[model samples]
Target: MTKEWMNWYRETLLIDAHNDVVSKMKDGGLDFCQRQSATHSDLPRLLEAGVNLQVLALFAPPDSNKSVTLQRILSYAEYALDCVDRDPRLHLVLTKRDLEALSPAEGKLGVILGVEGGDCVGEELWILRLLYRLGVRLLTITWSNRNALADGIWEKDTRGGLTSFGKEVIKEMEALGMIIDVSHLAPAGFWDIAEVAAGPFIASHSNAAAVCPHPRNLSDEQIRCVADRGGVVGVNFYGPHLTEFGSASIDDIIRHIEHLWNVAGEDHVGLGTDYDGMDIVPRELEDVTCLPRLVEKLRQRGHSESRLEKFMGGNFLRVFKTVLPD
Candidate 1:
């Protein structure tokens, strides 16, 4: 490939680590949920952007009662895949072979399911097994509220971090080959996970707390812990997590990428555009189609083409390769 074509390919190989497309699609309910032209991430946009791997999140807020939430999220995931099945051009990856089968030649976009919080399990181990069986590969222990598993960073009590139940949950996920996600976990909760998590894991959609100071973001120590553990951190697009100053811009986004690539190293840093979850995106890097511009910025900064490829989607794919069961 020519240098120009190589740059084009490098810029577009995105693996958006967290997206609420399914949850948003469910807002319209079963009957009226077919059209995705309404959201930021529809099948067409992802393909148009050449997004190679899409992490579709089964996101439920803290209050979603157990039995009801899991059913809804799983149902939403199934429905999302249903759309892909109907489209002959779309490819939804569920196995190692399916991942290998995809190429830019065969509609590069590949969908993977992730649960954004453990509250949906509702103290039921069966739910974890079931969700995994149903194709959930990444599971977060908590959202912004305390749960049977762990305290969220936003939990008011903050008295406890990971409860006794949380450890079991982590172990269960480990044995099942599911990636433990620490994005919204409390500080102590993060440590508990870092200590006992038997396999590779990640903070799917978070930024450096040292830069942003938001409870939702990870501290420098937290970033280091994840990196040292051979894990990756997908720096979030949300401005609140990206900065303590004023409104955010593309520069803020690049700087965070620079900082994360510096601190976490290029192998351990990637993108988790919380596109549908946040009201705003970084300037210039607005939607799925705009992601290529980021690669240009990285190139202008003198990032090698190969390292930039890892940042785009290679890092996340590497983690998935480790966590996905044979």
Candidate 2:
């Protein structure tokens, strides 16, 4: 890597919008504080990546019992909290003030909690508030199946959008200053969020459907809606999302970014490396430590420093400060 890129990587407020570290650790009985080679995230690796802020997704399987899922997720949250408490290099970011005070240069990894599916809240809106109190500032309305709020990509055949409860959830989330994540929601549900949401909402870990044509990927129009609403579209690094084939390389990732930058504009693009959440990753980006290499590649591709900064973390940081409550 170039010295200039290394300096920028260390100095910039690098934010990864989505990662499934918590769920992976819980399922695999892994330790977050140790150097884990089998997984994509660990305290030491994240810190070494110079990750200023990382959103660790707390996901429950869609078919699981809602109450049980919530309890398990809470336990996972507690474990993560305990880990943070024991380690001085880790900080759990619960408020906008915490985010504002973050200085990655100080070597602390500011961690944010995101729920991958709203199913954990069951049919009760109050449950959403309860999760918010527990430090989950971002909520993905669905996973790959139908839920109380809306249908996921798997339910696209219904062409259904958000239900009455889904609209209510969006309203309450906005009032509470929690970010509405539309990553797994079906296209119809995505449009529903775009229409009902008065403020910005993000596709926390989606790529360009126009490029890869995956059901999980966003179309050009959807990308524009996100940008138009001043929300960021975090680019997912999973190979399946990046290409028609199952395998992908760094060029494929750059291709998605180039397309997203065109469709959504520079201000709305950011990284959402779905690390530990996917089985396959681009060869060039094997783990979090390879993030700087991607930056260098983007630079070589002719992205200006300012645009690179936005794509790297500035865009997501802007949304976080706006949506995260005090």
Among the numbered candidates, top lDDT falls to 2
TM-scores for the candidates: 0.92, 0.98
- Candidate 2: worst 10 consecutive residues by lDDT? 60-69
Q: What C-alpha lDDT values do all the predictions have?
A: 0.78, 0.90
Clashes of each: 1, 0
Top of the candidates by TM-score: 2
* Residue 13 shift from truth in candidate 1, angstroms: 3.8
**Model 2 stretches astray by more than 4 angstroms:** none
lDDT of 2 by residue, 304-325 (tens): 9999889888999999999888
Off by over 4 Å in 1: 1-7, 10-12, 29-37, 156-159
Residues 1-326, model 1: lDDT tens digits: 35785556744466878887777767755321233555666666777767778888888666646777777777877876676667766566666676666565346567788888888888888888988887787787888888889888877355567888888889998888888899888888899888888776799999886677788887788888888888899977887878775468878888888888878888999988888788767677677677767777778888997898888888888887787776
TM-score of model number 1: 0.92
